[model samples]
Target: MSEKLGAERLMPNEWRDDLEALDLEIVRFAIICQVKLLEPGVIQRVLDNDARDCIHGNQTAFASLRGLLFLHFQMQKDLAEAYGPSDATEIVRRVWAHLQPRVGDQLGSLPNPGALSAV
Candidate 1:
């Protein structure tokens, strides 16, 4: 059998760390969107404005916007797959219920260790 298929080929620590960081950032973004500090649609408006500019903006700007949208949709897919489909309100409730204890006083929470397996 190939070494790549062997148990020793488990993911490297750096990749694991990167995944953890991404998960934390995703959760933080979600929390920020929930807080009332920003008016509703403010985020969407910002993204839309950037997107408009990207039409004539440099490649880096377009790539940045594309990356952001990819991450956004990826989070949505992960949430649905992890918690199942439901109203947005119910999904938010489930997300917090899963996260609150794990995060406690922290600004944001990482997924429960090993929760990434499903993701």
Candidate 2:
């Protein structure tokens, strides 16, 4: 990844012109997983309160944004309080905790606890 920060991590097209909550969830998932699964834009924009633009004027998108923000802050506070000041290390652990590895991801890598490798 580039040495640049969050917004800098995104490709031009990765940014969502829309502020739908589901769309923003993609970004939140990226953050929690600690992997750049998407070319995510900056979290600052994702967290913007005034960015609510729901199609049909429904509140789902706005509600989703609120939930996402709550989750982000809660996780931040939880990790800090639980793990002390080891942000980097704790983040790695958090990523793995949330990881849903595909078979391809594990074919030759991580071993399953009780499963034998195919010969």
Find the candidate with the highest TM-score and give its number. 2
Instruction: Give a tens-digit lDDT track for model 1, residues 23-84.
Output: 45544543443321123343343345443322244545444444554564465454445444
> RMSD per prediction, one decimal?
10.3, 16.7
Displacement of the residue 71 alpha carbon in candidate 2, Å: 1.8
Using Cα atoms with residue i matched to residue i, what is each candidate's TM-score against the true structure?
Answer: 0.30, 0.35
Candidate 2 local Cα displacement, residue 16, angstroms: 28
User: Which pairs clash in the backbone of model 2?
Assistant: none
Report lDDT (CA) for all predictions.
Answer: 0.41, 0.37
Query: Which lDDT tens digits does candidate 2 get at residues 13-107?
Result: 23222212332464444334332222222234335543322223334544465466556455444434544436523443334334434222321
Score candidate 1 by TM-score against the native.
0.30
Flag regions of model 2 displaced more than 4 Å.
1-41, 52-59, 87-89, 92-119
